[model samples]
Target: MKQSGNSKQFAKKDGEACPRGRPREFDTDTVLTSASQVFWNHGYHATSIDDLCKATGLLRGSLYGVFGDKHGIMLAALDHYAEGSVARLAERLNAPVPAEEALRNALLHYARVACALTGERSCFITNTTLEMQPGDEELRTRVAAIQRRMATLLAASVIRGQASGAFNSTLDEKAVGDFLLCVMQGLRVLGRVAHKEDALIGIVDVAMRALV
Candidate 1:
């Protein structure tokens, strides 16, 4: 996985300890990055505690002591990825460029990620949703909330585009946002099998034209 450029923003001061543990020697953000990469590379079910331990360079005792259990760690990882993704979206949408252009750039950015040469080449939240069991309401709820936040950001951009006459003013902003969300998710799913950036770009072009 690409090391998060925002790691330092989330980094704990060195040597912070969990509620009931020795002082932590490892950086928490760094650990999560590694753990998230492991989860991203391997589905939740296929991932083992040993894999996490090896990836994070922590012993099982340390992992459990810090995160409580594998599930806790997974939640932490999800939060880590989700927070970064939403923050990046906000940054992109808030850029000084025309809103329509920002939206296009955002779509193209994620489209490229969907076809990345390494990592999962899919949204972490989407991957988690697919692996979540029916009984996993908490997991489902978390994913749903994150997706909703993403949709809201997209909707805001749509509204901006409409204000600037870059998009159809008659269209419902929320519905358009939802439509884009579906397209972005579809790109990730299709990219996994096709691994084709050109195909993903074609979908993005369709999405952009639809907004216009």
Candidate 2:
């Protein structure tokens, strides 16, 4: 959508005082959070510029100025969600608790979020990844890289568990990490159709067996 007529340009000399009552600057993180929720609720292909504008409270001009286009907004939202996910995983996995317990807690955390009352159930990353077309190599690659980052964090935890005699030493650490990643993604999908929190937690419980 094109910008509304209300959008105006401002010009000032270098030392001029700032215009009074200027609109507050947009918080990019806040906008991305709202946009990410819109994308999660409606897959990337289905979310329109109007939807984003409504969710983020930004005019079309401001949205385009900040993100360039619909695809740009989605990309920014995906990166925002992925960065937060990685940070949370690192915090949980790097804690002083036993590796198995730490991993279980991590899985349980996803379970809780999946079961939350939010109308949308799918994860922002998982939903966006699944919606990607075959020709979207750049998008596919970006998704792969993010998954690898999370998997690496999981693998490191598994390796630590192996070293400490807490996890199955016979299992390949990387493979177990990949498996956990799959389980987490599966929880996101299951969360879409299942409302019962116990169902998701049960899956986490079953997934923990891999560490044993």
Q: Which lDDT tens digits does candidate 2 get at residues 84-114?
A: 9899999999899988889899999888887
Weakest 10 consecutive residues of candidate 2 by summed lDDT = 9-18
Local accuracy by lDDT, each model:
0.81, 0.81
> For candidate 1, what's the RMSD?
6.9
Misplaced by over 4 Å in model 2 are: 1-25, 117-119
Q: What is the lDDT of residue 33 in candidate 1?
A: 82
Model 2, residue 59: displacement in angstroms? 2.3
Candidate 1: pairs in clash: none
In terms of lDDT, model 2 sits at 0.81
In model 1, where do residues sit more than 4 Å from their true spots?
1-22, 118-121
- TM for candidate 2 is 0.83
Compared to the true structure, candidate 1 yields what TM-score?
0.84
Model 1: per-residue lDDT, tens digit, 103-124?
9889888788878845463667
